[model samples]
Target: TPIKRAWIWHYQRDDRKIFIKIGNILNLNPSVVSRNFNKLERQGSDPDFYAKTSISERPRLITPHAE
Candidate 1:
C-alpha cells in the first residue's frame, strides 16, 4: 500500500494539498484517510519513520481507469 504509506508521509509533513490530492485521486474520503493514520498512531506505529525509509523512491502519478 504505497499510496497509504505516501499519505502518511504527507500527513506527517502537513502537506495538506498533496495528501488530499492523493485521497481524491484514490476516491477516498478524507475521514477515511485520517482515521487510518490515527489508527496507526494509536498502535504506536510511527508511520512517518516507515514512510521516510520506504518512500525514498519517487512517487508516480497513476490515473485510474474509467469504469
Candidate 2:
C-alpha cells in the first residue's frame, strides 16, 4: 500500500515531492528514502536484468494511462 501511494505521488513528477510523500507515509527520513531509491535506480540500470527478474514480473503498482 505504501508503494501504491508512493507511485501515485510519483505522478506529481517531482522527486522531492515523491520522496517527501513516501517519507511521510513510511515515517522514514529523507536520507533513508533516498538510499532505497538509489538502490532501485541501480538495479533498474540493467534493463535486461530487471526485466528478467521476478520484480519486473510483479503486477504494476500503477497503470499508465492511454495517451
Estimated TM-score for each candidate:
0.36, 0.43
Give me the displacement of residue 34 in model 1, in angstroms: 0.6
Q: Write the per-residue lDDT of candidate 1 for residues 42-66, one digit (tens) a residue.
A: 5343233222112333333222321
The lowest-lDDT stretch of 10 consecutive residues in candidate 1 is: 58-67
| lDDT scores of the candidates, listed in order | 0.42, 0.41
lDDT of 2 by residue, 8-42 (tens): 43344346766566567656665556545544444
Regions of model 1 farther than 4 Å from truth: 1-19, 39-67
lDDT of 2 at 18: 62
Error of 1 at 26 (Å): 1.2
Each prediction's total of clashing residue pairs, residues at least 3 apart in sequence or on different chains, is 0, 0
True-structure RMSD, every candidate: 11.2, 9.6
| Candidate 2 TM-score, C-alpha based | 0.43
